[model samples]
Target: MKVEGVLVLDKPKDLSSTEAVEKIKRLLRVRKAGHGGTLDPFATGVLPICLGRATKIAQFILEGDKVYQGTFELGIITDTYDLTGEVVERRPVPELSAEEIQEVMQGFVGEIEQVPPPYSAAKYRGQPLYRWARKGVKVEKEPKRVEVLEFRVLAVELPRVEFEVYCSKGTYVRSLVHEVGLRLGCGATLVALRRLRKGPFTLEEALTLEEVERLQAEGRLEEKILSVEEALSFIPAITVSREMARRIRQGRPFSVSVLGSLVRLQKVARRPRVPWLRILSEDGDLVAVTYYPERFSGEGWAEMLRVFVS
Candidate 1:
C-alpha cells in the first residue's frame, strides 16, 4: 500500500533506529520510509518514522530540541560512555549532596562545547568512530557546541543518579553524564535512557512495535499516522489559490505581495536562517514547502524549495 505520514514509535531497548524503521516499513508494507532522528540501540522512546512524502520534512524534525530522562552510575567509566561498553575505570564515589550535583549540571546549561564519545556514530575519516574503535584505534572528535536548555537532577542514590535533560539537537546525554561524573571525581556511565520528546513529537502519542503490529492487524494503523501538514504544524503556513499552487508545483517564483495578509512569517527570534513556508491548496492539501528568503520585501519573488505531488 502507498502510505504517507509520520508514525511515532516508543522504540524498544536493544533495537537500533534503522532496525525500527525497517520493522515499521515491513509492517506497514510501505516502500518509502525514513526516520527523523537516530537513537542509540541502548536508548528507547520517541522515534518518528516518516513514510513516503512525509520523509521530506524529516530534516526539520531532526533539527528540533530533544528531552531525555536517564540514569547514570557513578564511580564507573566505560569506553562507550555508557554501560553498554567495556569498563574503562572504577573510582570511589565521593560523598556529595544533590545540590552539588545540580551545580555541576547547571554548568553544562547554556552553550557548551562537548566531545562526542570515542565509541559513537560520529564520523572520522569517512568512517564511523565506533568502527575505528572496534579496530582498537580510538579517535577523539573535535568538541562541538550544543545547547543544554535544562539539566535538572531528579534523584541521587549514591552510585546511581537520575536526571532529565532538555537539550538542542545533537546533544549527547551520555557524554553529559560522563562529564558530570568526572567533575564529581568519580567517572560515570549511562545505565538507562528514555527520550520523552523530539521536536513536536512526544512519547505520549507513540506506539510500541507490538502496538503497531496489532493496529495494522486491525487495519487501523493508518488512522494514527499524522499527515504532512499536521506533522509540520509548528512551521508557519499560507494557503494559495489553485493557480498559485500550480505555479509553485512548476517551480515558479512568487511575489511577496500576493501573500498579503496571508504572509505570516514566524517571529524573528524563532525563525531559522532560511525560513520555510507551507503552501496549501484551496482544499487545504499541502502543495509545497517554499523558501522564504531573508530580507524579503513586499515587491520581491521567492522560489519553491520543494513541491509536493498534490
Candidate 2:
C-alpha cells in the first residue's frame, strides 16, 4: 500500500537534499516522493520530505520562511562562498567590535537587495550559475530583494562566528555571510550550516535516518509519517456542505449561493491578499485547496487550485 504524508528528516551532513529524499524513499519503500527545500551537501537539518500525494503541496511548503544556524570564518572568501569551494581571497582579520558587527547585521534585518554568489544554483540563461562558475565563466547576476526577518550573532570566536537567521524563502545564508564580510572589509566564508526550521516543521520534530531505519526494522515506521492533513495543519480548514463537497470531488466549480448558513465570504477569506484555504468534505477530509475569486475576478466562488479527493 502507498502512503501519502510528509516526513521531517533530520538530514546528516555530506548528503544532498535529493539524496536524503532518496534515503527516505528506500526506508519507506515508496515509489513517489519529493522534498520541499534543497540543502547543500555540507548542511543538515529539517528537510521536509513529501511522500505520494503530499508532493502536490511541496511548492506551498517552499514558500514558507526558514530558520538556520551556522558558523562562518572571518578573513576568508571562497569561490562558492562556503568551505566547499576553493579559496579565492583572504584578508587580515581586523579587530571587530561587538557593537559594530551587530549594527552592520541589523541593517540587514529588513528588506534588502542581495546578490547571489556566482557559484550558486541560481539560474542564468536557463543554466545554473554554479556550472558557469565551475568553468571560470563570468555572469553578472542582479541582486534580488529578500526579507531577513531576523539575524543575530550567537558566538564570536576570533576566527569563527556562530549566528542564527530567520528569513524568507530563497534567502541564501552563504550570500549573507559573504556580504557581512564585505561590509567589514574582511572576506568571510561559511564553514558549517544547519537549518533548524522550515515552514512549520522544526528540527526537534525531525527523525534522523538512523532512527527511521530502526523504526522500519521494528515495523513501526508509520509512526513518523505525518498525514497529509497534519502536514497542512498550518492552514485553517473549513467544512463544506455535501453538495459543495460533491462538486469539488467532481472537479466542478460552483456558485457561492449553494453554500448555506456556515459559509460566508468574510468568514473563509476576508482579505484581498488571501492565498489559499482548505476545503473539507462532509466527513472533514481535505478535498481541495481553494481560493476566493472575489479578490481577482470579482466572482462569488472558491476556485480549486488542486484537488486531493480520494
Candidate 3:
C-alpha cells in the first residue's frame, strides 16, 4: 500500500498551503508528502499535493505557468494589495470605458518588473517582510522580473473588474491588479481569486477535501493519483538496458558514446539552460532524471539530476 503519486486538491479558502498538505497527509496516512506550489490561504483551486516519490518532481511542477481568475475593486487600496489586508486608502471611482481598461491590462502582457507587497511572504534581511511590516517597520524590496503571457478583462462593472491572467511562475496576481489600478489613476485591491490551472494540473482534475476523505474511506483514493511517470510525461524519455539503469540508480555517470544508436546525437544552434530527460529502464521504470543537452556529441555525458531509489 505504498502511496506515491499526485493529488490535485481544490484547496478551500482560509487554509494555508502547508495546512492543506498536512490535512491530505493525515487523511491518506502518507508518510512523505509535499505540495507542487503554494496558494494563498484566501485563494482556492488547483493545488497539487505530491505523495511519496512524486515529491521528487514537485520542484519541476512548481516552475510551470499558472492561470488565475479574480476580481479587483477600483478606487480602494490595501496594504496587502488584496482584501486580506487593511484598507489604506479609498477614492472615488472615475468613469472609464471597458476599452480603456483593456488597453491598460494589455500593457502588462509581457516581461515586466514588479515589487512584491509589503505584507507578503517575501523575506527581507532574513525575516519575512510581513513580520517587519507588522512591527510598524517599512521594507522596500527591489523589483523582480516576471512574465505575463495573457491578461484579459472578463468584465467591468464600475468599481469592480473581473479578469483572467496567464503568467509565469512567481507572478503575483495581487500585485498585477494593484498595478493596473495605478495605471488607471485610481488605486485598486484584489477582492477575490481562484486558480484555474498550475502546470499540467487543472481545477477540473482536482477534488474537494471532503471528496478525498470519502474516496479514501472507499479505498478509491488511488484513482485520483497521477503516477510519477505521467506527471513528468512532458520530458523526453530514453529507455536503457538494465545494466545502464542499475548504473544510473547507483549514481554512476555513463558516457554519451555508450548510448550510441539508442540516442540520436544532434547539434543545436542554442542550448536550453536546463533541459531534462527521463532515464527509463527496459521495463519502462523511471530510473533517473538527467540533464540531456541538445548540442551534445559522442563525448558529452549525461548529468544525473535525481536517482530513483525504487
Q: Report, for all candidates in order, the number of backbone clashes.
A: 0, 0, 0
Regions more than 4 Å wrong, model 3: 255-274, 292-294, 297-300
Sorted by TM-score (best first), the order is 1, 3, 2
Candidate 1's C-alpha runs over 4 A off are 255-261, 264-275, 291-303
Q: Relative to the unseen true structure, what is the C-alpha lDDT of residue 24 in candidate 1, on a scale of 0 to 100?
A: 89
lDDT of 2 by residue, 1-310 (tens): 5767999999999998889988888768889999988888899999999999889988778877899999999999998899999998989998886677777778799898888889777899999899988778999999999999899988887778889999988899999999898998898899999999998899988999999889878978787789888987776567877877887789786654443223464365443223567778778788887653334433466567778866
Could you tell me the lDDT of residue 66 within candidate 3?
A: 94
Per-residue lDDT tens digits for candidate 1, residues 261-290, read 456442322254226777788888888776
Residue 217, candidate 3: alpha-carbon lDDT = 89
Instruction: Give lDDT: candidate 1, residue 150.
Output: 95
Model 3 TM-score, all chains together: 0.91
lDDT per residue as tens, model 3, 219-249: 9989889999888876677788898789878
What TM-score does prediction 2 earn? 0.90
Off by over 4 Å in 2: 254-274, 292-297
Cα-based lDDT for every prediction: 0.86, 0.83, 0.86
Q: Which ten contiguous residues of candidate 3 have the minimum total lDDT?
A: 265-274
